[model samples]
Target: MLTLWCPSAASMESAKHAPVSPVLPSYEQEQHLHAFHACEQRHEAMARLLVVVWDEPGRCDLRAMTHVVTAHLRRHDTYHSWFEERGGAIVRHVLTDPTVIQMEPRTLGEVRAEDWQRHVMATPHPFAWDCFRFGILQHDRGFTCFASIDHLHADATVIAFLMAEIRSAYRAVLDGEGPLQLGPPGSYLDYCASQRQRAAAMTLADPEVKRWIAFLHRNGGRMPSFALPLGVLEDRYHAEYVHLDILDDAVMDAFESACHAAGARAIGGLLACAALTERGLAGRSRYSVVTPTTTRRSPKAFRTTGWCVGVVPIDFDVQQRAFPELALTAQRNFDERLSLAEVPIELVLELAAGLPTVGSVATGGVMLSFMDVNVPPLSAHIAREWHQANGRVYINQGIAAQVAIWLFRTPRGLSLTAAYPANETARASMHRYVKAFAGACRQAAEALMPTYSDAGREQ
Candidate 1:
């Protein structure tokens, strides 16, 4: 069992007026609003993964960690608005249990495979007005903390980045450095304001926008939903971490070669891997992956922090072409989507008022599967350290029960994980799917290597 301590009224009051600007809503927010409205109409729970990574100091100090986290909240507007926008509630909690903390292992592989499954199932949703709960686990080498956040509030990228920053702050405090001054906190409201200005200023749609609109028109304005195997409903969600080594020299060589040979960016390579994985799993061609693209294509958005992201579909037909060819296709699609990502999906839906809604598509028998490939700015050492971290590093959270795949890249290689509901497929089937996906990745990499080398020589 874990115990939680509520913050003092005085503390809450003082934290309320922290200096922060309001961010305008981006096109993404408009889409989310539409989705939320739809979900409200259907009364179905919106699922998301809430993850927490704690440092391995081997001690349990719920209050201390909370205090450290709270202090930073004072300086960051994003932190403040996050809690405020959610009805003046922060869905977060702190757990103080030495036994729980002691159970986590020090190394990534040593972490119990069942830990993730148990954590997700047993974890309770924070009350509509309460902050998220944080569970502390003790391992032989250090302590681990767990949190299951609601996806409706924030996606994994933001959550992961926030967690990493918090950990960095906590570690700095532990080292006797006063909390690092993270510059003036950017407000989400400000971002929203900027978005409004951009939208207002735009008169003509770009070519990419035209292409997307045409695609939407061809598809009849229905968004596809991924199908989950029925087996997922029976078994609990469990997580496993797999590590692959890509030495510094190898990573640099691979990065340069892939970029030059394919005329694609590093992220393109990651997407190509995802396409290969999907090809291996479905064992067919003509599949589409919906991925999130940051709307911060403009220089102004570079420094601004807000939820300015929208989903775009990348369609691939593996049977019709080779992996390299597919990689090029994926790259082209990604580039085009990024250019027009500023347009909100909600706006598109609104513009096509007579088109069928997502619900209607579900009723009409269209299955949608997606791959979210997150390639964070990777430095060689940081990638190595993540691989070295203890506990299972999972790429997928089986929240939708659909075949959702997540890819995280490091200097060594890519770490790919897929999550499916246990009730949806047999264990053998799931394993086979994973194996096939891995093989596709290897084939894609091998086929691209020579092309990359030849391009490098030409250069």
Candidate 2:
């Protein structure tokens, strides 16, 4: 049976007083602590957006959020990757005194959506090592918990887990429930321990390890000639933000169903569309792309999050593959690499750190991520403007790749967002590419339906 770390009711009740262990950096992180510092130096503004919505304005309490966040930080030390400025290194230290900023409530119409996104992207977390900041965005109707974090220490999963914990603590406080305790716990420290154990048990000569090295080489190979060459690294402007694009529930659900019929995940159909869109620009069916995946296993791992993400590099030739076939091909590529998910990316880069490879960020300028999660501890009684909108918030610092594409499933459905350097790629061209991506996804999904399958069989 699969192991899960869920706590029973009694254990949960007693967990409030449970003592937590001291936090430390993961084994992989300890090995590359200096690299994390270097990354911080390169991108001074590395924070991403995190917004929490609440329904009842009067009932919303910033104090509750503060108590929960501070307490939660102590419970999970991975949340704190404080960079020691004096020593010029990263160290884990749960801040006993974390600054919680509170702002008066404002109206959602205070700024346009694009401007809001731009503002968030430009604002980095004040303390470089601490990673995240907490504040209250007071609105006329309700309040939003506005948080920002350093990408160096956390991923979306980390962000999700943190939010969930904070929400739980906040609820407990509001209900006079007491300090929320985590039961049947699996912390980031545990993840680090597991990774070190796994790494120790394996060797580079192992088939899977060799496959990863080769995969890195494939990504490190020559970059594809895009319809438009991505902006050079030295250019004054690297990338510009494009308006968010969305696919509502009906379209997203239909697309998902289509993918299922073809024995593929939504990602397969997405990759198929992306390749076709590239074909529009390059007039070539051969292409390579990168997809980021989480390595967390079991409910315990999900209970606590950290920088536990890995990437899969895929190369495909769509020159003769039809939409459904291309989708399946993409699915197969992802499945093959799933076995290597547990291998730390740092290990792969260490093996081929400076070697020439297409996977080099400069050579391959495209990156993609897919997310569909609800902020578990977050729900407002009242529906606000953000609630009505079907779009997902997206921000990229151009640290990973020059062109970034993200698809997220919101309450309404799936939303697609794209970004590219304004200097190299025209806004007009980016718009066309985004639409083409949407169109390709729709066409592929339709082609995968059983009716389409029957028609092909009849032929």
TM-score, predicted candidate 2 vs. hidden true structure = 0.73
> In model 1, what is the error at residue 7, expressed in angstroms?
4.1
Best-fitting candidate, measured by lDDT?
2
Tens-digit lDDT string for candidate 2 (1-459): 001112234422333233333444554455335543444677633313343322324435645665565565455546534434346534454433223211222233455547645544544442343344444444566655545554544566654455556656777899898877666446666676677677767766777767776765654443333355554553223456654545655566778777777778888878877888888766866767767777776666666646677667667888967777787888999888776767765555545456665243322346777765533322331112245422123445543334667776656666666666665345666777777777776665554343433332210
RMSD of 2: 9.1
lDDT agreement with native, every candidate = 0.46, 0.56
lDDT of 1 by residue, 125-165 (tens): 32222233344555666666555444333444454445555
Which parts of model 1 are misplaced by more than 4 Å?
A: 1-46, 60-64, 82-129, 138-140, 196-209, 224-260, 266-287, 296-306, 316-320, 355-385, 391-402, 420-433, 448-459
How many backbone overlaps does candidate 1 show? 46
